[model samples]
Target: MSVSQTSGTDAVDLAIIRELSRNARISLAELGRRVSLSRPAVAERVRRLEDSGVIKGYGVHLDLDRLGLGLRAHVSLRPRLRSARKPQVLRDRLLAMGHVLSCVHVTGENCYELTIAVRDAQHLEQVIEQLSEMGDTTTGVVLSEPVHPRDVDIAAWLLCED
Candidate 1:
């Protein structure tokens, strides 16, 4: 189920998610072993999680450099009133571009923040040009990712029985 402010997600569901996030490739048997459930039981749980929209599809983490996309950048964009490019229009445009990894509508000065992967500086410039059509953009190259994706904060979301 959706872990909204109202809907209460079970701790077991949280644990299952934590393990799955760590390794989505984990076999049902192994996952069951770790979570102290039978294979079928765990399978049922995972199925529910998926059906409930808690578990999305599994995907591989790609090494972009090996894939020929060496440059990674975050392009902050704010829509210009002079153009037909509003936030929704910009989102559609960004989604259509192959290099755009993620385009999230955010709070504050910028309307959108885009995570982009490209071949090089030249490629980044071309992408920036596309973004500029939609809005004013400030590009920042991601030099390092000190802390990346990890498990969700358990205490923050998971309400206790006590």
Candidate 2:
């Protein structure tokens, strides 16, 4: 169902979503307190959210730099595939690669955009070479990440509904 039509995602649920987005590691009691609900009430709401697919599985945010992957880059792929099956083949190849953090099929000149983490420039070059085999690649190394992931603006979504 569309989000606008979805039940149980009211202001309270939006508040819960906002809190969880900021920190998924928050305890149930803390989450409840933040949303001004009893722990059990909040738990039920959370369970409903999960069942409805409004809340997907939680995850960890790893520090790639701490893990020796000091370099991060965005790779834009413009496919050179002559056959229809070649795009799927490229996707499969990317899915199997450990360094590919995320790949998105996009509009415009680039068919796919990928975020990749690597140990250094050499590793980045190696990954780019692999990507080049499928299509032309334009890579931009990330100097700094001013905005991190998982910081969704749930309030803005509610505003847009009006």
Candidate 3:
């Protein structure tokens, strides 16, 4: 029932997944039409997908600029010697900060990489200052996203795996 095992799924299931990835809010009738299935059949298949853990959940994409948090930056942290042993403490602190969009633990000169959104330069400075208490921080402001975030190519990935 796992995503890589298409034995549990068929072409119709894959088609439904492709459509949902493009637009999760699409109506069931529309989804059925796109996949050549009845509405009830589509619904049942979706439920099966969910129950099998092939489809985890849906999420909303928010506009940071519209929310007045236009400044997006990436901060790389090389922990101070004292804090290097307990990375979880720093992770917990980041989880409490609303400005942190994502944090990844990495293998490199830097211990953690964080993506943060703030209101202005001052706000960005404030976030950096806070991070500095835990580690040496390097920050870079994002100019633009040329390639916007997108869904995974399910067929190319899950289907082609041997």
In terms of lDDT, which candidate is strongest? 3
| Residues forming the 10-long window of minimal summed lDDT in candidate 1 | 153-162
Cα lDDT computed for each candidate against the true fold: 0.80, 0.85, 0.86
Residue 126 lDDT, candidate 1, scale 0-100: 95
Better of 1 and 2 by TM-score: 2
lDDT of 3 by residue, 48-125 (tens): 988988899998889999999999999998888575537687778887777999988899899889999999999999
TM for candidate 3 is: 0.83
- TM-scores, in order shown? 0.83, 0.88, 0.83
Tens digit per residue, CA lDDT, model 2, 1-162: 535445547778888888888888899999999999999999999999999998988998898899999999999998787641276776688877779999888899888889999999999999999888878999999999777766558645874674
Clashes of each: 0, 0, 0
User: Which residue pairs collide in model 2, if any?
Assistant: none
RMSD of each: 3.3, 2.5, 2.9
lDDT of 1 by residue, 101-159 (tens): 98788899987788999999999999999878777899999998887765455433554
Any runs in candidate 2 off by more than 4 Å, and if so which? 1-8, 82-88
| Residue 71 alpha-carbon offset, candidate 2, angstroms | 0.7
